[model samples]
Target: MAASPSRRDRTLSAHHRKKQPEQVRRALLDCAAQIAAEQGASAITIQAVAERAGVTKGGLLHHFDSKQALLAAVFEDLLDKMDQEIDRTLADDPASRGRFTRAYVRACFSDRLLGDRSLWGALSVAIVSEPALRALWSAWLDGRMARHAETDGDQRLVAVRLAADGVWLADMMEKDGGLKRYPQDFEVVLLAMAEGGN
Candidate 1:
């Protein structure tokens, strides 16, 4: 005869028997990101995230010690995705000069962060308003800038990067048509500058 599982075992199984620890952690981060994207960062309570992620509060705690920690982790995850997008963009370009800067411009214009209604757009409010998140973002920017110092260090390239950032910021804050309101050739001009053109 087969033996039946006990209450504790059933509870454990219900929580995450099929998912590995990493999977659970990933799920938690993804759930948090979705909540932040849809409802803004202020809505990301631990209880809300845990319930939405199909885990108990204690289970979520096992992965993230506190709400602030979870928010930081979610922000880091978003930055990681941005890094991947930049890397993919870099891979397609053959030019060495201004390569990293060009990738940065491309990423800024990418759908992931282009407008107020985007996932990154939803999260940008937190990135700028939350002190902890802003610190993390600053550190990340500093590191990338340092790494690309050799290739993207030209003054003109730096100016182009700044322009791209301005456009992205404007788009994020725009309540109307977003990036479409900008000149159609805006990105092209940035890319041309990235390529060291007139």
Candidate 2:
């Protein structure tokens, strides 16, 4: 019989084995996102994503059955990532409890700064034009905002939330030389609103 594998070999075997499928899935998603970033959402289809991912169409179908499913996956993945980021940001705050409002606002700004909004923004045209995608986001936001009702349902808090989203949206949709003016202390202003200092 062959000699038993060494610990190093076994460890490498397990690590690579575990990572393979997840890496493939991540690669597929990245390809789909790149398509959305470079070509717009309408360009994302099974064949297109497969080609971008350097996988067979059958491989793409193994991950997503249809374009609708693919788009849903993209939205769900992106939202899930943002939710995790919000949770982490909240945990790092000095006053964690009852600070969901501050955490939520900070998270959106962080997303604008260090996140994937540009790719998602490129897909905004598709999101706006596609009634189904619009409904998907609408329902998701409705449920999410309901959960953060204390922050989003109240008038004062809602104003800040909407204002942040509006700014981010404007930034996303802006074309060169369209507008350059923004409140210099915007995040500071948002923090004040969130902290009831305004």
Each candidate's lDDT (Cα)? 0.82, 0.69
Which prediction has the highest TM-score against the true structure? 1
Q: Looking at candidate 1, what is the lDDT of residue 136? A: 95
Q: What's the CA RMSD for each of the models?
A: 3.8, 7.5
lDDT tens digits, residue span 1-198, model 2 = 999999788767755664466777788888888888776777888898988886668867877888988887786777777778777876787663235667667765663442233665665666777777788778867887778665446667777778777766665676321125434257677778777422
- C-alpha positional error of residue 89 in candidate 2 after TM-score superposition, expressed in Å: 1.5
Top lDDT hit: 1
The TM-score measured for candidate 1 stands at 0.85
Count of clashing pairs, candidate 2: 0
In model 2, state the lDDT of residue 165.
72
Q: Please, what are the lDDT tens digits per residue for candidate 1 over residues 132-197?
A: 999998999999989988888878988998898787677668734555666536888888878942
Q: After superposition, how far is residue 197 of candidate 2 from its true place, in Å?
A: 7.9
Candidate 1, superposed: residue stretches over 4 Å from native = 1-12, 15-19, 112-117, 183-185
TM-score for candidate 2: 0.73
